[model samples]
Target chain A: MSTTIKVARPVDWTGIFFAVVLTLVIVVPLLVVGTWAFTNVWRFPSVIPQEFGLKFWYQTLARADVWSSITMSLTLATTVTLISAVICLPAAYAFARMDFPGRDILFFSFLAGHAFPKFGLLVAIAGIFLQLNLIGTFWGVVLIQLVGTLLFMIWIPVAAFQSVDRRMEEAARDVGASPFRVFWSITLPQAGPTIAAALLLSFVGTFYETEGAWLIGAPQVRTLPVLMISFINNQPVIQYGAVLSVLLWVPSFIALLFARRVVNSGSFAKGFGA
Target chain B: MSVLTIKDVTKLFPGGTKAVDSFSLEVADGELVCLLGPSGSGKSTLLRMVGGFETPSAGLIAIDGEDITRMPPEKRPTGMVFQSHALWTHMDVFKNLAFGLKLRRLPATEIKRKVEAVLELVGLGGYGSRRVTQLSGGQQQRVALARSLVLEPKILLLDEPFASLDQHLRERLREEVRDIQQRVGITTLFVTHGQDEALSMADRIVVMRDGGTEQIDRPDVVYRNPQTPFVAGFIGTMNLLEGTVANGIFTRASFSHPLAVADGPATLAIRPEALDVTPAEPGAAKVHRVTDYGTHGLLDLDLPDDTRLKAMVSHPAQYRHGMGVNLTPRAVSAYRNNAQIFRSEA
Candidate 1:
């Protein structure tokens, strides 16, 4: 008997099309900025740089204001990540494990905080900060950034804590660990990846935040992104801004790489039941 | 030896649902007592209270005459095995076993030795480095047991630790758990809905229903002499028939079990295995259905009273469906107003 073989398609064409579109949308801008960072001169309609060199990269790194901007951005991002994580731990725990009157309402309020448009809220916050004479201060910038990142940080860890089995906590307690120990050993370890993701997101959010720093810390405190925008307004220094933007992209890329493994490990309960 | 005592323990959950009501029991050290009941019967809730996971609304739980009712779980000297085994996924088998030992600040050498010994005890001696997720269900269960066992707790609370395993594994693990409990001689409180688990493993089975203790007795006694209709029906397959007691005879539509000295509205209880099915010239019952298991068969008989009685017969194929047969109960229990008033001779 003769059999006719029909070849099957190897890939989903529609999905491939969407993926290609998304990759181009995300990757083309990075490629353009990267090219510009090394370009000496590239006018409109120029597909590639007319002259290539590392002068912009060195200038972006060596400038005193740029150096301080980098330092200030690092400090702000680190502070935001640390504070967001510390403050959200207990709040997330309450949201995940407790059932009191107004618990849902309080959680929903946090969600609403996250949902509110940052630009509109920033204008109001800037006015308030100006009235309080808090503008142009480091703490003032941090406070505003905290308002933007707090809800996101809490929202993530709440899901992380909720995914964990309460029985595991109870088991830890049964084995003679104190409640705080249970939180540290069992609850916190189980939520490691999710917390890492949240912190990374918080750091990235703060480091690249332009409006918050511009509105709250302008001239006095110029973070990397705000400094990038400042460079953009100058005709000769725009390439340096592209270099700075690419420099700011490094930590976030590294974070993404680490997050993929941490989130997927899901090692919390290898054989342990959900 | 730890003697765990629960006195007047009542757990009233939010919304006024009584998960455990005025429950009390005494368990001597090394005794493995099982709480057997259906779901929502408060077995797990009672065990949680004993483990100090849930505070009793009103009552006292004392272990070895020391009141531990208000103590936190960490200070209560109890180790619990959750139903899902609840082994920490972040830790390997050795770390899981050594967790409690580390908390106690035992020396490194002592913790290592104790962990290895417990792993060996649970038949997992060489699995110390393996992640818990790498182990099979049965192996993970052994790790959970070992984790608790290495703690050397005064009381071990097991909440259906083997409930998730397949039938063969469940059977093997139940025996292994019982063996381990015997060797360790720790006072244990086991909770399970499976009657077979309770019957085969428990020294005394505390049968519960609707937040109340139905009967507490030796497995043989509980199986043979269930005190309440609920216990009889819940613990095993029981043929319950409603009848009235008059003229020293308890009579259903056509079925009768003699009551030597009682009269009232009554319920007749007979184990399916206790009733014998045979062909009779004047048989008043017809076989409605036959379900054949490997070792025995269950015959559903339709009686004149419109009540269908289940009878276990060894040779099921000999009696066809709709076949005329007579059911003679070799042993029986009679309940008056839900309480047993009569038990037949063995």
Candidate 2:
């Protein structure tokens, strides 16, 4: 009898092809945006920009409204994140660790924020906000942004808290630690990484949110994304819109870096039940 | 003096299931009593009640004559070693052991000294700085034990601490835990489902069934003189023959035993070692199978009345399948209505 030996292939062409396709799908648009942010003149039929300078960057930075919009976006996002965390985190813990009547129904109700078309929900809430004289106010924008954060702040942290080992808490209690002490020392530290990741995601999502801010804070509360819409709509120079777009990516880019660290530490997957 | 006392404690869950039913126990200052049972036997629930993790529907738990039935777990002067070890993954071994001590307002130097002493006692002398997540299963369990022992709690409750390990590791850790318990001389209540664990380690074993205790006695007494039929069938291999006792003789079909008891329907329980098996022509029983287990052997015998019995033979090489064998009971216990009525001398 003769024996046959087969060698394994070294390179997988199918994998390589998909990798290149995916990279182009994500990177191509960002590359075009980067190119337009610096281009001063680009004529027709040119593969690359015909002229490049810092004129648009100087113009966007010199405007006082641009700086106020930047400040407004940060303040609104920070406020929304802080208030949502305070309101939602304890509720998440209770939903995760305690058993009560109507627990599942109450927990899944947070999904109502994202279940339907968000604009439809916004339009409905905007009617109520107008009736309450909350339109064109900071708190109105804050309340609307809070709707977007409920799912992340409640669902992800609930999973994080649920994944913590109950036995560890029991061990702490058995060895003379109070209930509050056990939560602070044992439970919180274990769930901290995943909760931090969720917070960052909520902040970045609220920062880039446009529809709510534009509808509720049209006259007074001008956020970065709201201002970016105006720049894209009314400004004659395309570079003005491109520069704001690039500036808008800054916080998200930093948050992505921090989120990657959190994911790499191995808690992000646990937060989503992966 | 008894260090811990539990009186008529019961736990009725919300669904009306009685997990524990008026269980009572008393432990001396340095005694190790094991609550042994299968699943749903309420051993763990009883242990949890002692640890103050569960409130009894009706009972009183006291340590040193002070009622602690309503006190929370943290104030109960007890420490528990869970089956999962439950070591904090974020802390090193030193911090894990020192946490309870720090909470007691002990000085940092005193905490360090106590932690080091316990670490040495559990045989992990210099593993204080290693992260708990990096340790092996046995080492993590030792850290858990050390964590509880450092507090010097009035009672130590272990709920199947070695249940998750492999067989070899389980035996070794069982001996180690018993040695540490004796050396420290702490009142300990250990709960386990393994018969070997309860038999070899406990000063007295509480055999539980269906939310209540069947027997509470020393290991040898529980093994040799099981008061109830459940304990007999649960603790070890026993040949239970259904028969009737009449005029000092227990008779079942063609087989009979000389048992001194009242005339009634009875269950004759005899250990495998107590039955002697010998080759004979036209015997009452036939050797159905023989298994040689290196140190000893087991013989499965079939009686003429279709009754199956097990007997231990020291020399199995002399017996063959289909051979006629005679069974003689060296000792036996007779039970009526699930309770013992008579026992024979060896």
TM-score of each candidate? 0.92, 0.92
RMSD of 1: 3.7
Q: Write the per-residue lDDT of candidate 1 for residues B61-107, one digit (tens) a residue.
A: 99899999989999988889999999999998888888888999999
**Number of the top-ranking candidate, with DockQ as the measure:** 2
Model 1, A20-121: lDDT tens per residue? 999999989889888888888787777777889988788767889988888999999888778878888888888888898998678767766557787888
Off by over 4 Å in 2: A1-28, A52-55, A127-134, A253-274
Q: Per-residue lDDT for A161-268 in model 2, tens only?
A: 888899999999998899889988998898887888788989999999999999999979999899989988998888988999999999899889878876785556
Supply candidate 2's per-residue lDDT for B17: 98
What candidate 1 gets wrong by more than 4 Å, as runs, is A1-28, A43-46, A112-117, A131-133, A255-274, B291-295
Candidate 2 residue pairs in backbone clash: none
Kindly state the fnat score of candidate 2.
0.91
For candidate 1, the docking band is medium
